[model samples]
Target: MLRHVVLFTWSDDADEERREQTLAALRRLPEEVGGMTSFAVGPDAGLREGNAHTALVADFPDVEAWRRYADDPVHLQIIADHVKPILAARSAVQYEV
Candidate 1:
């Protein structure tokens, strides 16, 4: 399987409502897009200082499935509509699990 992981840092002005909105939008992706074996996303636990604001992990059957998820219109729309406005930085990786 392939595991996709992403970390996001929010802009300084990001508020709870905006963050919640982004998370809620992301939570809908698995239903909207296909080929995901598993998916999870959430805000940081605050157990460590300087951690990214949020993280997402998704599992797919193969690179093709991951690619489909990457290019999915629903995912793109969520990023454009909910994430970009408040996003300060992002890091992501995909690897065999």
Candidate 2:
């Protein structure tokens, strides 16, 4: 299996409602996009600065499936619409399991 991980920071003006919506959008990814075996997210509670506010973990059967999901149109749209507005810094990592 392969794991896809993402960590994101919100803009300074981002609020609770928007964050919730962002989480909802994220939670819907596995159902909307194919090749996702599982997904999980959590709020970042560390008090340190320069920390991401949220993180996402996705499990895929293989690299090809991961690529298909990454490039899916609906997922792309969500990234452009709902995600970009609230996101500041972002980082991702993918690896075999």
Top lDDT model: 1
Q: Model 1: what TM-score?
A: 0.97
| lDDT, model 1 | 0.93
Model 2 agreement with the true structure over 1-97: per-residue lDDT tens digits:
9999999998989899999888888888878886888889778888888788999999999999999999999999989887899888999999999
lDDT tens digits, residue span 1-97, model 1: 9999999999989889989999999889899886899999999999999999999999999999999999988889999999999999999999999
CA RMSD of all predictions: 0.7, 1.4
Q: In candidate 1, which residue ranges exceed 4 Å CA deviation? A: none
* C-alpha RMSD in Å of predicted model 1 compared with the true structure: 0.7
Error of 2 at 70 (Å): 0.3
Query: How accurate locally is residue 78 in candidate 2, as Cα lDDT from 0 to 100?
Result: 86
